[model samples]
Structure formats: structure tokens, C-alpha cells
Target: MRKLYVIGIGAGDPDQVTMQAVKAMRRAEAFFVIGKGDQKRELVEVRTAILAEHVEGPARVIEIADPPRDRAPADYTEVVRDWHERRAELLEAAFDQVEGTGAILVWGDPALYDSTLRMVEHVLARGRSAFDYEVIPGVTSVAALAARHRMVLHRIGEPVHVTTGRRLREEGLGEGSTVVMLDGDCSFTEVPGDDVRIWWGAYLGMPDETLIEGPLREVEKEIVTRRAELRAAKGWIMDIYLLRAAEVRHAES
Candidate 1:
């Protein structure tokens, strides 16, 4: 059986590539680069840079175009499931073509919001491709946000709820702090609280990185404007933010 290594290349920074990830990259004969369209061309360049800097031996890069996904579906879960099946088909076809060790470089940690691991497993479940694979964890964007801001994710011993923008809108903020990802709508604006503070970062770990931190009411408009400008300038943007009541703000101020 051939082997596959699903490595996390970290969020937006080539330096975030771990030693373990480097070793895996060196061992692989080919890497599968998932395409996120032309708007995110910078992300692909970042992966290429990582391979160039670390991989001592020769490695082949296989670009795989991602299947189309419904941007606004009434049934999100079902739509995602169908999209994953299509993606698994593509991955299986690519894996079948490769004879030696292959890899897939995922952004952030695979265990987080990413769907690569699930797609890999789906391909295996079909009994079409058999390959032993290992996971190499990397720094998540959440970590990058905290490190860049020099702030903790939550207040003293409080639990942090990591969720998506959709959920944050539907469920409201939980106890402690809320770290929101996959939010295209700047859902923080709809979070329904004036006393909250937001620590937001966009293009984290990249040259165009931007950060905003202040009371929600004071900085919400600024964040919205900056986010739109950044997105328009770059053609794409990925951002994450932490939201909680202004307890910490009150204490510090």
C-alpha cells in the first residue's frame, strides 16, 4: 500500500511550518495542493514557499481543483456532505495516479474546522484507495491571533467556545469567550452586545495581516470598514476574532 501524510502547514505563515511537517514533506514524493480559486492565490504561493524552503529532496506538487460548493444552501449539512463526496472522488483519483508517498497540505490544524481529514477518510471508506497516512499538527489561526495580540483567549479559567459565524449568529455568545471563524458576514456585528470587546485579526501571519482590538461598540465599524477594504484589496480574506463580555475590559481600564 502507498502512504499519505496529511500535514498541517499552519495559518498564513511559512515559518509556522513545524519540524515534523518538514520531515513529512521531505519524505513525500508528491503533495496534493487543494485549490481555493484564484482569489486565494496567495495561499497557494505560501505552500509553495514552504516546500521550497524545507524539502531537501525533490517533490512533485499536484494541484487539485476543489469541487464547487453551495454558498447559500437551505440545508448546510447535506450540501457539505455532497460536496465532500465529490472532493473524495477527486482525491481518490489523484491518489490512484501516484505510485509513491503522497501528501495533502492543510491550512491550520486538520482537527479544527478543516474538512480534509473527513474527505480522506471518505475516500478510504469507499475501498478504492489504500494508503497509510499520518497527521502532522501545526499552529492554528486561533493561536496566531492570540500570539499576535499578546492576549489570552478567555478570562481567568473560563472556557472558550470555538464556533463558526453561522453558529454564533444562531446560538449567541456562550459563557466565557467566543472565538469565531469561517465568518464572511462579520457576524460579530450581529452578536447583540454593546459591552463586549473584540480582538480581531485578518490575514494572520501574512504580510498584509491586520488586527483590531477595542470595545465592540467603539471598534465594530472600524473592523467592518477595514475588513471590507482588506478583502477588496486582496480579493480574498480569512479572519478570526475573539468575543466576550467587557468584564476583562472593565477590570483593565
Candidate 2:
């Protein structure tokens, strides 16, 4: 391929797609899709639907089967590095089969907790194939979560820390407010203190979207229960949440 576009479509909602993303999608002759296995076929469907709704004609889609990796790894960094290398191999081979401008649609933004951009870089660093690439930014799940809850991220002039569930478990909450992602364990339950409040959301934009909010101690159990039930029903789940120390004064405007 002569060129590629790494586009972020948004958290989940089709309406979240921006005009910049639409333009980038139109410019590409084919799309290289990755990581949509049987368990999450609906994810690829959402991307396909986005293309159908925005593009002038039918768009070409190329599916690349993802290599399996250890989900619960003893050494997280090394395992993830090896997995990305494997993914880069697949992406390189897939790109070679197709010609002309192509794009890879990424969930959420490519910068946060997604590996598409890294794998793309890996493909180029191998020097096997060369293609100029551009990134199209889209609304992030963090933004979507904040919007859904109708709340600001932090108090006046305070910081908002964005972290993973594992890190939250290890480091505990940071100053000001905390937004946790990629948390499968419901780490909010691990957060100490009854003074914390939480606003959580799942399936941010899709039809089955769910939201819950209240003091952490009071609603943590409910959030955990609902998360399990949703995952059981759908076989997959994507969720994010914000936690704040309730004792932090709500400064007067």
C-alpha cells in the first residue's frame, strides 16, 4: 500500500464519528480490521455499519486474524511486547496482499490502551513494507463517560488521573479525581474508604448502554454485580469509571 490511515471511530456510538474520520474513511480504498474474533463480532459490525452509513459506495474490508496471547500474564510488559510483534507480522502480511490507500479502524482512540498504532509502527520498523500513514482522532470513551454523567473531570485547577485497574490496585487513588479504564476486576471495590463516590458506564453508546453512580461503598457491589451480569449476557464488556473523594469540597462557583 502507498498510504494508510489509522482512524479512531469513537467509543462505540456511530453518531460519535467525526467529519474528519468520515473524510479519512472515504480516502481509503480498503480497511484492514484486526482483533474481531467470534466473541466480539459485533464490534467489527459496528465499524462496517459506520462505513456503510458514511461512505459513498461499498468499502472494502480485509480481516486479519489476531494471534492469541496470555490474558493473565505473570510478566505483563514482556508478554504484551511479544504479542505486538506477532500482530505486526500478521499486519505486514495482510498489507502486502492489498494495494492502494488503506485504513485501520481503531476502537476508542489509538493513543489510549489500544495497540493498533504500535503494531503499525512495528510493521514499518521491520522495513518489509513502507507506507505513509496518518491518524484521525475521534471522541474517546473518557469523554463519552464524562458526557454521559454530565460532570466535569476534576475540581477547580486540580488534576484528573487516568489509570488502569491494575495500577489503581497497586498505587491506590491519585490526588483530585481518578478515571480508571481496562479494569476487569472492579478495582473500585478495592479502593479504600467510604468517602469516595463513583460514576461508571458500560457499552457507552450501544443500545444496551448502562450507567451507575453513587457513593463507592454503597454502589460498588451493584456495579460489580451488573458488570458480571452484562458480561455473562453478552460474552464481552467494555467499561470505564471515575472516582472522587466525596470529602473534597465542591468549591463554590
lDDT scores of the candidates, listed in order? 0.92, 0.93
Tell me each candidate's RMSD, in Å, in order.
2.6, 2.1
Clashing residue pairs in candidate 1, if any? none
Expressed as tens digits, the lDDT of each residue in 217-245 for candidate 1 is 89999999999999999999999999989
Error of 1 at 243 (Å): 0.3
Residue pairs with backbone overlap in model 2: none
